[model samples]
Target: MNPPIDDRKEYSNNFLSTNSPIYERFSQHTPRCHRGFDLRVWLNNEKNLTRTTCFCPPSFYGDMCQYQNQRISLTIQFRVLSDSWSTLFAIIVSLIDHSKQRIIHSYEQFTYL
Candidate 1:
């Protein structure tokens, strides 16, 4: 009996020429995803493969895996004392939780002049 032929090339070509806004690329550094396949073996096997949506970083989120995930924003400000050489700084880290509420983690420090 003959083995089933792989039609991934044709499927990929068709996907690329489609009017869909999604773009596909293959990379070995795809981030961890519960729904993704284990590619450790595939990575060690071949390097002559075409690009596909199977590999995408965690910073990206989408059906076709083209959109970028929103990231937590961090801001830091430093001020110097006029009388002495002490430094005053404030660090603020803000992350949006799954419930759409803002969660902030802040650290402030100052040196005695």
Candidate 2:
């Protein structure tokens, strides 16, 4: 059962929730994502004719989310001396292949204080 709608939340990522708020948007016949959520709608009035769109996680992509992007996400945390709490950090994160050339598939840069 779903929680009462009158309840408000400070923040909600319904897509990531077990008792998702978005469930109210789908029909009883709608299918689960199998690690990805499937957004489906009937094409025309045919019960057998339906279109599906997958809302995949960062590690995946594709029509039904059946394929992997061959990349892993990473998270990092750091602590500095109390005096340096406000110091800025210049960080670069990358995904590199293990082959001889060490190919860089993608990267991200972060500059924050």
Q: Cα lDDT of all candidates, in order?
A: 0.50, 0.73
**Per-model root-mean-square deviation over C-alphas:** 13.8, 16.4
Residue 70 lDDT, candidate 1, scale 0-100: 66
lDDT tens per residue, model 1, 1-113: 64445676666577665354453334334554434433433333466544334455687665445577765565545565677565544443334344655554444443442
Model 2 pairs whose backbones collide: 33-36
Q: Which sections of candidate 1 miss by over 4 Å? A: 1-53, 57-67, 71-82, 98-113
What TM-score would candidate 2 get against the native? 0.39
* Alpha-carbon runs more than 4 Å astray in model 2: 1-60, 64-66, 69-73
Q: For model 2, what is the error of residue 14's alpha carbon versus the real structure, in angstroms, after optimal superposition?
A: 51
Residue-wise C-alpha lDDT for candidate 2, range 1-113, written one tens digit per residue: 76665543423543356555565555355455655887777887755788877799877777767778674557888878988888989999888888999999888998999
